[model samples]
Target: MQLFAFGLNHQTAPLAVREQVAFNVDGIENALRDLVENGAAKEATILSTCNRMELYCNAAKPEHAIDWLAEYHKLPRQELEPYLYTLPRDLAVKHSFRVASGLDSMVLGEPQILGQMKQAVRQAEQAGTMGILLHKLFQNTFSVAKQVRTETEIGANLVSMAAAAVRLAERIFPSIEEQNVLFIGAGEMIELNAVYFAARNPKRITVANRTLERAQTLARQYNGHAITLSDLPEQLAQNDIIVTCTASQLPILGKGMVERALKARRHKPLFIVDLAVPRDVETEVSELNDVFLYTVDDIAEVVKDGLEARQGAVKEAEVIIESGVSDFLHWMESRDVVPTIRALRENAEHSRRQELEKAVRLLAKGESPEKVLEAMSRGLTNKFLHAPTHALNQAHGKDRDNFLDVARRLHHLHNDE
Candidate 1:
């Protein structure tokens, strides 16, 4: 099977296109099963994060897997083809290593992508779609990531999306300590943002989710309060900063909701960061007066400031990743030879067993042990050499010379004379 990876990421596609093909946590298992059961791939792993949606697969033809993505997402193939990147074999292996090492992330050396990848692998495994190739690929991928993290300073001076959100909020307001912070959703991104925002010791932090129990769980971690989504209307105006990242397909906060909140706050400037892909806050909410709204893409500029400092670490990380890629590819090549090695050993064992059985029968029939042993040895040697000797005899000129060299090397013989 051939290894391949194809997808669109933060660099290749904007949030609009990326969100269109994003996979939900609940749908991943079915999607992976569909990819493998329908013959698009022998094994597959779908890594769908806020910034990217990549399918790493083992297939004879990548087109089938690519087509499956478009069809699965119900998008026109032509519309999505322009932004998609397809990497095959070595390129795929290299890309997987780099991605896991944080080399391919928008925020240079952010470590969140590595955890996101681990979650994707777990999903694939639970779906029962993970096979030998992808299993080995991710195993190597994780090892490379760990090596890069330990050997290089790639994660140094990193600016995560959560950190960027906090930075942006600080720019708008003097100090987060004086402002009440509102975090929507209890997902990984929201949890991380909560941690960063909590570090500033926001006056009052509130986690609002569809489920109060889940929101309460995250809220307690930061010594914050928890509320249901229904509480946003009454509680929205109370907070000066809001960071939202939810899986809701529809907008959680609309323009009217924010307008009312603004009126309640008496036109006090409110800072909002929408970290969701489809967007928890409506796009029209940005047009509201006295509101500073930022999306995930809007944080890109803030994330770039530390890029120059980490440039040197990138080179070091790449060196480690390259070494890892070479090792993984070598392992893959060795796996390819397993069948041949097994067959060769099996063939030799069969020949030896046949000769041993004949020798045993001769001894049982009262033949001398020395003679039987000699005959068996002769028979085994002939059986082992027959193929090579026949090929050598049939060879002529250049072919014969090449065959003779192969034989000499096979037997470790030297023409010292």
Candidate 2:
């Protein structure tokens, strides 16, 4: 199987296209199964995040996988093809290593992509589409990611999405330490945002989720409060800052909800960061006079800092990634030889057994031991040389030249004996 990774990311596609093709947590399993079922991929793992929607696959043909992604998403292949980048063999391996290392992220050197990749692998495994190639790719990806993180200062000064949300809130409140911060959902992104905001020792931290029990569990870690989604309308007006990231297919906060909150607060500025891919906050909420809204894409400019300083580290990362890619491709190449190698060994063994039997019969029929041994050696040698010698004699034209050269090289090498 050939290794490949193809898709669009923050650098290649705008938020509109990215969101259109983005898969939520619920969609990953089906997408992976569909990829294999449709003959697009022999094995597949799709990584869908706020900034990227990539497919890492092992397949007989890369074209089939690319067409599958576009068709499966109902996107025009021509339109998506411009943004899509198909990396084959070594390049694909390098991309996987770099992506896992966070060198490919919009905000370079962010650790979250590693976790996102792990989640993708888990989903692929659950879907029963993760075969040896993908399994090894993911395993090597994790090792490379850990090496990059530990060996380089790539992750230093991490002004990630969670951190950027906190920065935007601090801009609104002057000091986040005095304001109440609310985090919606108990998912990984929300938990990360909660950790960042809670670091400021906010007046109070509240986690609101569809499940009150889940919210309470996450909230208790920060000495905070919890509430169900139903409590938002009653409790919304109380918070000064809100950060939300959920996998919901629909908007969690619409114009009606925020407008009501604004009136309840009598025009107090509310800082809201919607980190979800499809977006938890309604688009109209951005138009509100008192609401400050940002998204995963909006914070892209903020978290993208120290490009020049990190350039040195990025270059270092590229070198490591190249080494890793070459190694992985070498391993894949070796795997390709296994069946042929096994076949050749079996053929040799069959010839040896046939010759051995002939030698035993000659000895049993009262042939001299010395004569039997000599005959046995000659028989095995003749058997080994027979097929290739015959093929070389029969070969003609292009096959003649090639087999003649091959036979000459083999004879010369063993003729030394």
Candidate 3:
């Protein structure tokens, strides 16, 4: 089986297409198990984030794995095919290294994707879908990532997605200190945004999540209050800034909900940043007057503010990635010859055993020991040379020249010798 990677990311597909294929954190293990059990792959790991849904697999037929992705998500093959990228062997290795190093991220040099990839690998391991090939690939990938981060400034002056959300909010409001902030979700992204926004010292911070306990835990960090998602309708109108990132498959805040909230607040302006893949907020809510809504994609431009400063580091990172890819491919090539190397050793041992047995029989028959030793040495020599000598005698045209060259090289024979 060959190493293969196929996926659609923020660069290849818009949020609408991405969300359709995005796997939630809870479903990753099952999805990985199904991919392997269904004969699509021998090994598999999935990296599903707000910006990308990637499957890394060791499979004989990569097309089968591609088809499996569409089938698993209930999307037509034709529909998903346009946005998908299929990388095989060396390309797969290079892609994995680049992704782990943050070279392939939508936000150049963002560090979060490395953690996300590690989480994906952990999930694959838990599901028993991580085979030797994938495990080695990720191990090398993480090593390369560490090398890049250490040797270059790719991660310096980073404007993360959370920071970008705050920047966008600053553009809408005169001052963050004057506005009340509502964070919807207790996930990492929401926590990040809350941290950034909290530093600006919003008037009041409230965390709303499906579970009150999780919300309460996050809210306590900011000296704020917590509420369940069910309290959103009643409490929504009180907040001017809403930041949401959740794992729910459906939109948590629909257009009707936002419209009512706006009405209750007497048409006060509301700024929302949704970092969720399937979207915690409805798309139509962007159309409402006095409402500014931003999805994960919308944060891309804002996050590019410091990209030019990191272009030099990108070159350094690419140099590191290319070296990594070359090393990994060489290792893979060496593995491909293992069986042949083993067979050659086994064949030589068999011939030696046969010759030794004959030598023992000759000694038992009272033949001279010295003569029997010479005979055994000669037998072993002939057995070792038999295959190459026979092949040389039978070969014709270019095959004869090729065999001669291989024989010369194998025995270290010079032309003069």
| Candidate number achieving the greatest lDDT relative to the actual structure | 3
The residue-by-residue lDDT of candidate 3 on 118-207, one tens digit each, is: 999999999999987899899999999999999999998889999999999999999999999999999988888888999999999999
Please, what is the TM-score per model? Answer: 0.95, 0.91, 0.95
Error of 1 at 212 (Å): 1.5
TM-score for predicted model 2 compared with the true structure: 0.91
Of 1 and 2, the candidate ranking higher by lDDT: 1
**Pairs of colliding residues, candidate 1:** none
Looking at model 3, report the run of 10 residues with the lowest lDDT sum: 187-196
How do the residues 1-417 of candidate 1 rate in per-residue lDDT, one tens digit apiece? 699999999999998899899888778999999998999999999998888999999998889998999999899899999999999999999999999999999899889999999999999999998989999999999999999999888888888998899889888989889999999999999989988988899999999999999999998998899999998999999999999998877789999999999999999999999988777888889888899999888889999877888899999998888898899999999999999999999999999999999999999999999999999999999999999989988999999999999889978988771
The all-Cα superposition gives candidate 1 an RMSD in Å to the true structure of: 1.8
lDDT per prediction? 0.92, 0.87, 0.94
lDDT of 3 at 113: 95
lDDT per residue as tens, model 2, 1-417: 888888888889887778778887888999889889998889999999988998988889989988887788788889898788888877878888999999988788988899999999999999999999999988988988888888888887767778888877878888888888899899988988888888899999999998899999999999999999989998999999999988887888999999999999999999999888778898889999999999877887788776666767887777777777777888899999999999989999998898889888988899999998898889888988888889978988999988877876866745344
Give per-residue lDDT, candidate 1, residue 139. Answer: 96
